[model samples]
Target: MAKYSEKASEKVEESMHETKEGKLKSGSGKKVTSKKQAIAIGLSEARKEGAKVPKKKD
Candidate 1:
């Protein structure tokens, strides 16, 4: 099992909401439509904030 900090979890939740509302966008200026992409964005944001998120799997 992987462990995520509370802050990271909250960021994921926030990103999910933005995705559902059609407000989330990718680095290429494309609107995000996939749930997996949204989650990735959230984790990326959490990482930027120094949240305790595990490194991406290869």
Candidate 2:
């Protein structure tokens, strides 16, 4: 598995928790229900925050 920075992991964990609680939303204002989507969102946020995360796959 790829190593994630502590901040990145924390963001992902928080996203997962929000997803499980049905409180995660998408950019289009839709509710997020998929695990993958939540993780993606978390990574996106981490990127925005300048966290040490890998580049997005092509």
Candidate 3:
């Protein structure tokens, strides 16, 4: 299992949160319709923020 810091976890949570309309769209203009995509987006953002973590390989 991989480990994530509190800030990383929070960033994931905030990114996955849906609006009242329940739409999941990433900032990159991609439609994130699944939890996996949401988490991926969050982790990607966290990585860009310089959070210490491993990057996922596609």
Candidate 4:
């Protein structure tokens, strides 16, 4: 497994919580229903904030 920064992990955790609460949404404005999607969203946010995260896969 790849190592994630503490901030990145926190963002992911928050996204997971939002997903469970049915409050997570996609860029297209659709509700997030998949765990993987939620994690991806969190990672994307972390990247935007300049957290120490790996580059997105092609």
Q: Candidate 4: minimum summed lDDT over ten consecutive residues — where?
A: 1-10
Q: Which parts of model 4 have CA positions greater than 4 angstroms off?
A: none
Clash number for model 2? 0
Off by over 4 Å in 3: 19-23
Q: Give the distance in Å from residue 25's predicted Cα in candidate 3 to where it truly belongs.
A: 1.8
lDDT, residue 39, candidate 2: 100
Q: Which pairs clash (backbone N, Cα, C closer than 3 Å) in model 2?
A: none
- Cα lDDT tens digits, model 2, 31-56, are 99999999999999998999999999
**lDDT value for model 2:** 0.96
Q: TM-score of model 4 relative to the true fold?
A: 0.97
Q: What would the per-residue lDDT of candidate 4 be over residues 1-58, giving only the tens digit for each residue?
A: 7899999999999999999999999999999999999999999999999999999999
What does candidate 1 score on TM?
0.95
What lDDT would each prediction earn against the true structure? 0.97, 0.96, 0.76, 0.97
Clashes of each: 0, 0, 0, 0
Question: Candidates ranked by TM-score, best first?
Answer: 4, 1, 2, 3
> What is candidate 1's local distance difference test score?
0.97
- Measure candidate 2: CA RMSD: 0.7
Q: Which candidate is the best by TM-score?
A: 4
**Cα displacement (Å) at residue 30, model 4:** 0.6
